[model samples]
Target: MAVAAVTTKRKRTTARPTKTQPTTNAKLIKQPLPAGLPREWYETHNRRLKAMRLAIALLDTGIYHPANASNRRIRTAAERIGIHPPSETTCRMVRSLIHYAD
Candidate 1:
């Protein structure tokens, strides 16, 4: 008498799904205006005030001197002061204020 051969198949395991991390963009996100400032200040005046203050601070510290006039550095300073760096035309206005303040 010959006995029949028995065969067995192994069961495959499935991988578990992983949770994905949230992606963040480098663009600045808008924040609500501070309470001390008027609501309209965010729309019109606060940005200019912050930019001028930043520019004046740089001039006071000799950061924007002719020998070291760096638009990149100025932009960084403006950002630190919570103002988006001015466009070329607005930068010209900031520069004029800088000149007049000296």
Candidate 2:
């Protein structure tokens, strides 16, 4: 009696998706804030901008959940993005942004 050999197919593996950087060289021009604005207004505006930046940085680093964005993590992300360490208020803002992003 002759026996037939059985063949098995191997499973294919796919690589995990990696974050991609912008290929364009687009740059943003820093226009000075409108003249005669109140100091508090300027401060608030700058703080909001910083929070947005930190949030984006954290997202890019694979931090999609707000729970993952601790004060230390947010501050570290700010430092990595060349910004000063964020205040507690700013950290909360960043987490809020991450949370609402979904």
Each prediction's TM-score versus the true structure: 0.42, 0.71
Q: Which residue runs does candidate 1 get wrong by more than 4 Å? A: 1-50, 64-68
Query: What is the alpha-carbon lDDT of model 2 when measured against the actual structure?
Result: 0.87
Steric clash pairs (candidate 2)? none
Q: How many residue pairs clash in each candidate?
A: 0, 0
Can you write out model 2's per-residue Cα lDDT over 1-102, one digit (the tens) per residue?
A: 233334555676955443443334645546688999889999889899999999999999999999999999999898888999999999999999999996
After superposition, the stretches of candidate 2 with alpha carbons farther than 4 Å from their true spots are 1-26
lDDT of 1 by residue, 1-102 (tens): 234334555666955443342235334546575678777666456657655776786787676543353566667767766777766655655666666665
The lDDT of each candidate is 0.62, 0.87
